[model samples]
Each structure stands twice: as C-alpha cells, then as structure tokens.
Target: MRPVLIAGGGLAGHACALRLIEAGFEVELFELRPFFGGRACSYRLPGYGGSEIDNGQHVLLACCTALLDFYRRLGVEHWIRFHDSYYFLEPGGRLSELRPRKWAGPAALMAGFLALPIFDFRDKWAIVRGLAAVRRQAGDHRLDALSMEQWLERHAQPPRAVERFWRLILLSAANEELDRLSAYHGVRLIWLAFYGAPGAYRLGIPQVPLGSFFAEALWNRYGRLRRHVGQPVDKVLINGGRFHGFEVDRRVVEGSAGVLAVPYHRLAGLVPQLEADFSEWSCSPITNVHLWFDRPVTELPFAALLGRTIQWFFAERGGSYLKVVISASRQWRTWNREQIIQHTLEELKEYLPAVGSTTVAQAHVVKELCATFSPMPNLEARRPGPVTAIPGLFLGGDWTATGWVATMEGAVRSGYQAAEAVIRWLRADRGG
Candidate 1:
C-alpha cells in the first residue's frame, strides 16, 4: 500500500498518522516547522543561561481521555502530574482553594465553594443554583446559540460572582471571554467535568517541556510511519476533483490518501474542494511572562491570580522561575515587551510579595496571536467535518467539528475521526 500523506505536524496530523499506521496504512507526515507539537510545542531562548521554555503551558484535565490516550501511546503518560486542588489568590493576597470534599456529587463541590472566604452566603447560594441550572440544561441544543455571559445573566448570577468565579473558570477553558463564549461549551464543561464526574476536574500539568513528546525518535517507534520536518506540502493534487497526492517542495508525492490536518486558516488554500470558510472563525491569543529571580519567590507549583491581567502562574526550579499566563490576551497585543514585563512585575507583587524584594535574573514574554480558534457563540456549527467533496482527502484539526473546542483533546479526536473516514473510503474504493 502506498503511504497516506499527511499535511501539518501539529497534534491533529501527528495523531492521524499514528492511527492510520495502526489501521495497516503506510503513513508519511510532513511538518513545516523543524520540530513537532505545533502550538503545543516548546522552544528555547538563546543565551539567558541556555534554558529551554515551552512556547506556552498546555495543561490537561482529568477528563481529557483522548489526550491522555495519545500521551500513553507515546509512553509519556507519566510525564503528567495531576492535581485535584485549584488555588486562587485574591488581589489582597488572600488565598482560596477548590477541591472535593469527603462526600461525593454536587455536595462535595458545594462544600469547597462554601468554604471560600471570597464568596458571601448570597454568592454561594446563587452559584449553587446556577450550577444546578447548568446541569439541567447542559444537553439543551439551544444553549449553543447564547453566550456564556448571557446564560449566566439569565440564571441570575451576581456581578461579582460571575466576574470572580464563573468568568475565571470558563475563560481559561474556552480561551475566550464569557461574553463571547458559547453557553453550550460552558455548561458542558461544568457538567461533564464537575457535575458528572467527581475527579474529572483534576488539572494535569506536564512535568517536562512539551517538546519532549514530539522527539523524532518517538515517531520512529511506529515502523510504518515516516516523518519529514521542515517539509511543507504546497498543495493537495487533484485531477478532475479526484484526490491524488500532495505536492511537496515542488515535487509530487504520491499517496493512497491524504489528511489535511493544518490550521483552519490554512485549509482552504491547500485543498480548495473542501470549500472551508473561516470567515466566522477568529483567533485567540495567549501571552506568557517568564520571570527568573535570584532567589525563590513562592513554593506553590501553580495558582490563578484574581483581578489581574496575569491569569495564572507556574513555578519551577525552587520557585526561582515562574511562568505567568494570560489567555484571551488581546489587550497585550499593543504593549511592547518592556511594558509587558513591567506590568507583569507589578501584578506579581500582589500574589508573591517576595518578588518585590528578589532581584530579577531574566525575563521573557511570548504571545501566540493565533493560539487557538476562539469558541464564540455560533462558531461550533460553522466548523467543518472530516469528510470533504474529494473522496480520499480528509479534514483533521482542532478546528473541525469534533464536538470539542480548539484543544489538544479536540485535535487528537479530529485526527482519529479523519483517519476513520479515510479508512472507510479506501475500503469502499477497493470494494472491501
């Protein structure tokens, strides 16, 4: 069998190649970048003690089964450390924790939420009622039409409660403001991970850099799989609207099938028959601020900052190194690097007061302008599916209609879904 050519080396493409090989198809994967992992990958900064840093922190939830399975397949499951507790710090340096109680079900979560000093009796009861409403309406189809903010407003959530609690959780998960996010996703997140399963809300942080999972040697473990980095597929060759192969580096590369696993923004140009229109699709930004101090600042592994532009921070190397993250960070697009660092330092002082006394050793800022497609209201229905007008060409990416937002789990699921489509098409083509 001729190898199935795959375009894009991101999670979707990588996952498709692996699944195709397992389905008895020879696979050839092309990545324009010199390495794998795409937006989830890590890169190093020259000088600055020769330290390697992730492009951005990509954490997973316990409920992300597909992503966990992908990591297990690569023998990197142990690299993830899952924690059940979430620490939130107030602007005045007060701390709050969210975790399961001794009992199970909503009662367990309610206990934790009630214990938080930030929320009053009214806020707590409003939230409990709000979550009960979410559980009841999670399966409703019309929720997709409304923004999360609208849903919360209709549910009578308090202004302070929405801003401090609901907005923080949903914003990080959907990578968009509550006002712009779909209520379906917001409710699904709360119900699936919190209401449905007790342990599903556990946060999983990779113990190592994300690039380690994309090592060339890992792909070699699959004998039928081949990888080509720095190789860009210029176009998917088609004759009379029939799928053929891909054109790479000005040369035709023959294949039995092809999977277009690139970003949503890059799909239409490479495979015109797909007729993918991303006019409604827009990009989201995530900014990371890394600060290294001469001495330790905080021992906490990670924490969410309240009432600040820096949403979350992760500590490493005895807390000397800290990575601050801001999702949906369009506000920082215009700020220069110096301004970003200065503002971040000011914000850090509130949570980690020691940062004021410690001398800064180094600092770096990375802003991913197109990190993920924003999950705005009405955007879910606009996403394309795996199959296309071209029989042997399949679409696979986080942007696809995988019933998931633009996430690693969604990307992996789309790859698997596209690979299934290709296998079924080829079998029918051969009259199998």
Candidate 2:
C-alpha cells in the first residue's frame, strides 16, 4: 500500500496521522516548521524569565467534545483542569459569576440564564426570545446573510446588555464580535454551549505547557510514525488532475493521499489553484499579554474583564500569569511590545487591586496576526470542505467547513474527517 502523506504538522495533520496510522496505513507527516502545534504551539519567552508561553491564550469550553476526546485518547486528560462556572471581573473591580443550576430540561436553561449577573431583567428575557427565534429558523440560507448584531437589533435586544454580556460570550466562542460575525455561527455557538451538557458552561485550561502536553500525550500514542520536522512543503506537484506528491526544498516525496492542514493564507501559495478563493477568506488576529506577578493576584482560575483594556485574565499554577486576549485584534497588531504590555498591565491592576503595588517579575506579549479565519457574514459560503476537486487530496484546517471557528476542536474534527475520507478511498482502491 502506498503511504499517506500528511502535510503541515499542526493539530489537523497530527490528528490525521494518528487516525490513519490506527487504520493500518503508513503515514508520513511533513511539517514546515522545526516544531509542531502550529498556531497552538508554545515556546520559552526570551526576556520574560524563560517561562514557557503559548502563542496566545486558548480556552476550551465544556462543549468541546472532540477536543476533550482528543485529550482522553492522547492520555493527557489529567493535564487540564475545568472550571464549573465563569467569573467576570469588571473594570471597577467588581466580580460576577455565572453558574448553572441542577434542574432538568428547560428549567436548567432558564436557571442558567437567570444566574448570569451581567444582563438586566429585560435583557434576560430577550435572550430567551432570541434563542427561540434561532430554534425556529430551519434553513441555513435564512442565517447566511445576517450578522448576529443585526439579528439582535432586529429582535429589539438592548445594546448595552449585548455589548457587556452577549458580545463577551460571542467573542470567546466565535473569535469575532456580533457585529461582524454570522448570525448562524453565533446562534449555534450559544446553543451548543447552553444546551449540550449539564455543566456546559465549564472552562478548561492547561496545567502544563502545551508542547509538553502534546509531546507526552499525542506523540507517545503515535510513536512508530516517522515524524519529520523543519521540512516545510514548498509546493504540491499535481499531475493528471490528481495528487502526485509534494516538494520540500531539493527533496521530493510521493504519496497517493495527502492532507493539507496548514493555515488558510498559506494554502493559496502552497497550491496556486486555490489562490483565487483564498484571498477572499480573511482572518482575525488574537493578542495575548503574559505577565508574571510576584504573587497570586486572584484565586479564580480565569476571569473575564469588562469595560477595561483587558478582556480576560487567567492565573496559571506556575505563577500569576495574566493573559489578555484581544479577539479581532487587527489594529492591536501594529502596537509595539512595550505599549501593549503597559496597557494590559494597567488594566490588570484595575481588575485585581493587588497587582497595583506588586512588581511585575516579567512581561511578554505574543500575537497571532492570523489567529483565526474571520467568521463574518457569508463565511459559510467561503468555507470549503475537506475533500477538494483533486483526487486523493484533502484539506483539513480549522478554516475548512467545520461549522466551527478556528478552534482546537475544529482542527481535530477536520483532521479526523480528512483521515476518514483518505482511509475510505484507500480501502476502495485496494478492494478494486
């Protein structure tokens, strides 16, 4: 049997390799970078006291089934801790918690909705009506052209409440604000989060560095697969309208099946035929400011900040690590490191008063200019499926048509789907 070549060694590639290997197929993974994990990768901070920091802060919701399953399969489920509820820290240092009550059916949803402190009484009722509207909408076309902001406004949603409560929730889930996000994506995200599990609002964070977690867990499971790093695929050579193979510098590797799991922007150049539609697919930026404090500022696992420079902060076990994630941060990317750090730290002090006098041991800012594909209106039309027009060639990135924004779960799901498609094709070929 010909070996299946998986390109771009990010989450999707890694996942594809794992699944294909399990299906008794020879797998060769090609990664352009010296390291793995792609956007989710981590490295030691240069001047920030040598602490390991991720490219950006990533949080998993309880509704992330695929991500949780991936962790369990990789045998690193213990490395992550889940918070039962969400805590929002206002700029004025006020704290608000959203916890779900243990009631059955619609009662639980109602209880959870009522428990949220951010929204007013009218806003709470509006949420119920909005969800009903989402449930009533049957076809995808109805949601395609509309933005979440427009949908809420049409439904008479309070702007202040939407900004403070609804927008925060949407920002973290969709990676874009309601005004720019698709109504379908926003509604789907909220529905999944609220209606999925009993503790659906739970948040999970990594206990160790992301690299170590992946290395010890995922790499260990697929120990036999020959992994090559620092070998970025420069070009994919297609012949007879089929996937012939790829070229990495002077070396050439051939495979019957391949999965392209790199970022969307990188895809067009890798395969020029994709250039036309690729440019139409825009991306959103995510910025994280990692600050090391002398002591713990807050006992909470993670806190959402409103009406401040900081959006969210998380306290890691290593230290009081404050992470400020600015989603749709296109403009923030232009700011210098010092300016970004100073602004984030000042906001941190406003929320956690203890950080006012305490000296910051270290500070670092990390940015992912193209952190995620923009989930704006009409994004559904732009997103492509795993299977392309080329035979034995598949695409598996968060940017693919996963109905999920650029997320770990989405990446893993795409990988799994691509691998399954490859497996079926290979099996049919052999049988023939």
Candidate 3:
C-alpha cells in the first residue's frame, strides 16, 4: 500500500498520521519545519538561561481526553501534573482559593464559588443560574446564533461577574471576547471542564517542554510511520475534485489518500476549487512573558490575576522562573518588548509583593500573533469537517469543525475524525 500523505506536522497532522498507521495504513507525514507541535512548541533562548522555553504557555484540563490519549501514546502522560485547586489574586495581594469538596458532584464543584470573596450573593446566584442554563441547554442549536455576552445579559448576570468570571475564562479559552464569540462555543468550555467529570477541571500543566512529548525516537518504533521534516509541500494535487498527490519541491509525491492538516490560512491557496468564504476566520494573539527573579514570587504553582493585563502566571523550575500569559492580547501587540517586560513586573508587584523587592534578572517575551482561530458567532456552521468536497481529500485541523474551540483536544479529535473518514472511504472502495 502507498503511504498516505499528511501535510503539516502540527497536532492535527500528527494525530491523523498516527491513527492511520495504527489502523494498518502506511503513512508518510511531511512537516515544513524541523520540529512538530506548531504553535505549541519550544525553542532555546539566550536570555532564558539558554534553555528551551515554549513559544507560549499552553494549559490543558483533565477533560481533554483526546489530548490525554495522545500523550499516553507517547509515554509522556506522566510528564503532565494536574492541579486540583485554582488560586486567584487581586492587585492588593488578596488571595482566594477554588477547589472541589471531598465528595464529587455539582454542589462540591460549587463549593469553590462559595469561597470567592470577590462576588456578592446576588452575583453568585446569577452565576449559578447561568451555569444551570448551560448544563440544561448544552447542545441547543440556537446558542450558535447568539454571542456569549448577549446570553449572559439575558441570564441577568451582574456586570462584575460577567467581566471577572465569564469574560475572563471565555476569552482565555476560546481566544475571543464574549461579545464576539458564540454562546455555544464559550459555555461549552465551562460546562465540559467544570461540570463534566469529577476531576475534569483539574489544570494539567506539562512538566517538561511541549516538544519533548513528540520525541523523534517514538517515530522510529512504528515501521509504517515515515516523517519528512524540513520538506515543505508546494501544493495538494487535486484533479477533478479528487486528491491525486502532493507537489513537493517540484516533484510529485503520490499517495492513496491525503489529509490537508495545514493552518486555516493555507486552505484556500492549496485547493482553490473549494471556494468557501474564509473571511469570517481571523487569528487571535497570545503573549507570554518569561521572567526570572532573584527570589521566589509565590509558593503556589499558578494563580489568576484579577483586573490586570496579565491574566495568569505559572511558577516553573522551583518558583524562581515564571511564565505570565495574556490571552486574546490584541492591545499588547502594539507594545514593544521592553514595555511588556516592565508592565508585567509592575503588575506582578501588586499580586506578589516579593516581586516588588526583587531585581537583577533578564527576561524574554513570546508573542504569538496568530495563535488560534477566533471562535466567532456562527463559525460552527462555517467550519468544514473532515470530508471536503474533493474525494479522498480529508481536512484536519483545530480550525476544522471538531465541536471544539481550537484547543489541543480539538486538533487531535479532528485528526481522528479524518482518519475514520478515510478508513470508511477506503473500505467502501475495497468492498470490505
């Protein structure tokens, strides 16, 4: 059997390639770059103690089963540490904790909300009502038509709760503001993470760098797996609405079927025949400031900062080095590197007083301009699935309709769905 070709070596591409090989299909994966993981990658930096730091700090929840499965396959599941509690800090150093009770249920989960001092009784009631609404109307199609902001307003959520709780979480996870994001996409994230499984909401942080998950040695084990790195495919060869091959360095590489797992921006240029309007799709940016301090900032693993540009910060390597993440950071794009570092320190001083007295360490800032696809209203209808208009051409990416918000789990799910589509098609062709 001719090895099936998969374009792009990112999460979606990697997932699709691996699934096909496991199902007894010869797979040839092509990555334009030297490494995999795409936006979720790490690189060595001079200022960062000359160590490999991730392009941005990406987090996962225990609810991300598909991503967890992918990690288990690589024997890197042990590398991720899941935190049961969430810490919140205000500008004046007031700390709050959110954790489930000894017993597991909705009430146990709501115990965290009861402990928060930021919200009033009315605000908490409104939040509870909104959450109940989400759990009740999870798969309602009308949710896709309304923005999360509009939905929250209809639920009579207080302005403070809407801003600090709903908007903050939604903006970070969905990579779009509540006003711009679909209610379905935003609420789905909250429901699945907090209310789904018992330990679903536990924050899973990779103990090692992101690139370490996809070690090159793992590829050698699968004889059916052949990865081509630093080899960019020119275009997908589609003749008469059917995938024929791929054009690589002016050479035609043939395959039985193909999975176009490239970014959403590259979709139109590769195959113009499928003329769908991609104008609704836009990119969101995320900023990560890697700061090393003379002393430890906080003993807590991580904390969310309220009413600040820096939404969250995670302590790494014994709490000396910290990675501050600002999601959907369109405003920060205009700021220079120096401005970012300075502002981050100022904010940290308010949350962690130890940071105010510390000095004499270099910093690094990583700004991913186009990190993920913005989950705009009605985007689910626009997101094409695994089966494209062309025969034997499967589309796979976080951007594709995986009923997810451009997350790692979404990427892996899209790949698995693509592989299933191809397997069904091949079986139909063989009359198996």
The deviation in Å at residue 387 for candidate 3 is 0.7
Query: All models: lDDT?
Result: 0.87, 0.79, 0.86
Off by over 4 Å in 2: 104-110, 138-141, 216-224, 274-276
Per-model TM-score on C-alpha atoms: 0.98, 0.94, 0.97
Clashing pairs in 1: none
lDDT (10s digit) by residue, model 1, range 1-432: 788999999999988887888888899999989988898998888988778899998898988888889889888899999987889898767877887685756567667767887888889889989988977898776898999989998999998789777988887887889988999888887776667556777899999888888887687788998899999999999976778899999999988888989998888789776676788889999999999999999878899998888899999999999999999999999999999999999999998899999999999999999998888888777777898888788999998998888889999999999999999989998998
Per-residue lDDT tens digits for candidate 3, residues 287-395, read 9999888877789899998998889999986788899999899999999999999999998999998998888386989999999998888888889999988888889
Supply candidate 1's per-residue lDDT for 62: 83
The count of residue-pair clashes in candidate 1 stands at 0
Off by over 4 Å in 3: none
State which candidate has the highest TM-score.
Answer: 1
Candidate with the larger TM-score of 2 and 3 = 3
* Per-residue accuracy of model 2 over 1-432 as CA lDDT, tens digit each: 567888887888888888888878888888888788898888886666677888887789878888888778777788788876778887778898776676556446557657777678888888777767766663455686899899888888787668776787888777787888888888777777766666766788887777775574457566447677898888887988888888878778898787888888787777886553765567788888887788887888788888864678777754476677787777787899999988887778888888888788888788878888888888787788888888888899898888787899999999998999898877786783
For all predictions, the C-alpha RMSD in Å is 1.2, 2.0, 1.3
lDDT of 1 at 56: 92
Clashing pairs in 2: 32-232
lDDT-wise, the better of 1 and 3 is 1
Native-vs-model 2 lDDT? 0.79
